[model samples]
Target: MQSDIDPRSLIGRKAFDRDGTKIGTVDEVYLDDATGEPEWAAVRTGLFGRDAFVPLAPSRVEGDALNVPFERALIRNAPDLGVGGHISPEQELQLYRHYGLPLPGPAPDAPGSGEAPGSSGSAA
Candidate 1:
């Protein structure tokens, strides 16, 4: 989450929840298409578990672990946006709502341009 930390290096690291519960391993890092900043991380819950997307803004890296400030169940139940490409604006909003995180930037339906917040595309 810190500017000094490389997003690419986050892959494969272990992630923990607020109560120090082991969630899973970081499977991928999603970068903001507009700012090119690290925005989300897809964690592999288990061998058969699907990858869950976690916000990177509030998450921090300590040593080799990624400390996520949310409950393990919340993280595990995140919307299945799937991995390996950009996260569309609509999908991003669903994630924000699911986490109860305040929406960033302008309102999604703001007039003027057709594109909404995070409409550019996410890089994983």
Candidate 2:
């Protein structure tokens, strides 16, 4: 598993393949809400084109460049965002739906549940 590295430090780092070809630069890191761990990285591909988000796990990070496990076809075929180069709210919703994560709402233990974090609340 990857350690909790600063996302800002990786923003402009080089992304590479197993063969060490220059792919692109890191754009942003997506965090898993439940774990606050990095789940994916948005990488810019193609000169002067839009970027795409690829699933990233801790094991993918190497000494300097990120070692993307999949082939270029998979990266090229991932979801495309416009030149704004950032994942938008709509895209996040789409990902959530695709992954079947519960939409954010009240905490499981609020006034109605009579429980709180660290207060005998049942784990969701």
Candidate 3:
């Protein structure tokens, strides 16, 4: 029995643990590339201000509140995002490697404007 929820309304809502303890607010949501469906939510947690990626499957929206399946202890026990406030680029690469995701290339506007795809743009 799935409930109808407005995605726009969910933005900036408070997230709470199973015990009704405030964990954090929703930072950004990550979606599965193939299906473009929400997979996880980046939750801003801790005093130092870091974001933790939490599984979206175990979460539900009720009016203005987001209920997560785990307790505060469990959430805190999860791995830290590390320096620079969030996970580092190298760490992100490592995570993608661990998950077997294909590494993405630079954007269309990246340096070397007219170079061919996959070409580093130096005379060989």
Candidate 4:
């Protein structure tokens, strides 16, 4: 998985949005409890600079930076998961919901069920 990586490798890397807007720097990485894989990144953001967690699923490390497919406002507006603490499943769910990301795991239907969120499957 692209999300699986040495969390240490991400610290201090610049984070940008899909539109190439610089959001902030990576402050910390949160690991998934079930798999011990890098799941979210705590980014230092905003004028005063508070840490906000952003999902790493669709994110990619490019050169010296990480690019997340989310706007700065969206990450800033996500639930305040805090800069420290072991994120509980409940808290994780809240974060996912706030970001409109689906809960991790298999889809409820087949791939052709039109359940995918960001795809047209194939051009008609």
Pick by lDDT: which candidate is best? 1
| TM-score for candidate 4, residues paired by index | 0.79
Candidate 2 Cα errors over 4 Å, as ranges: 82-124
Question: lDDT per residue, candidate 4, 50-108, as tens digits?
Answer: 88888888899988889999888898888886766677666777788888887666346
lDDT of 2 by residue, 1-124 (tens): 2666776666777887556676688877766544465656777886885576655552267777887765666566666644333345466555444433444443666454442211111111
Candidate 4: residue 59 Cα off by (Å): 0.6
**Where does candidate 4 have its weakest 10-residue lDDT segment?**
115-124
- Residue 82 of model 1, lDDT score: 88
lDDT of 1 by residue, 8-123 (tens): 89999999999999999999998887667888999999999999999999999999999999999999999998898889888999988889988777446656345566543555
Each prediction's TM-score against the native?
Answer: 0.89, 0.61, 0.57, 0.79
Total colliding residue pairs, candidate 1:
0
Of 1 and 2, the candidate ranking higher by lDDT: 1
Best by TM-score: 1
Q: Order of candidates by TM-score, top first?
A: 1, 4, 2, 3
Superposition error at 35 for model 1 (Å): 0.7
lDDT ranking from best candidate downward: 1, 4, 2, 3
CA lDDT scores, all candidates in order: 0.87, 0.57, 0.56, 0.75
Deviating ranges (above 4 Å) for candidate 4: 1-4, 106-124
28 in model 3: Cα distance from truth in Å?
0.5
Candidate 1 worst ten-residue window by lDDT: 112-121
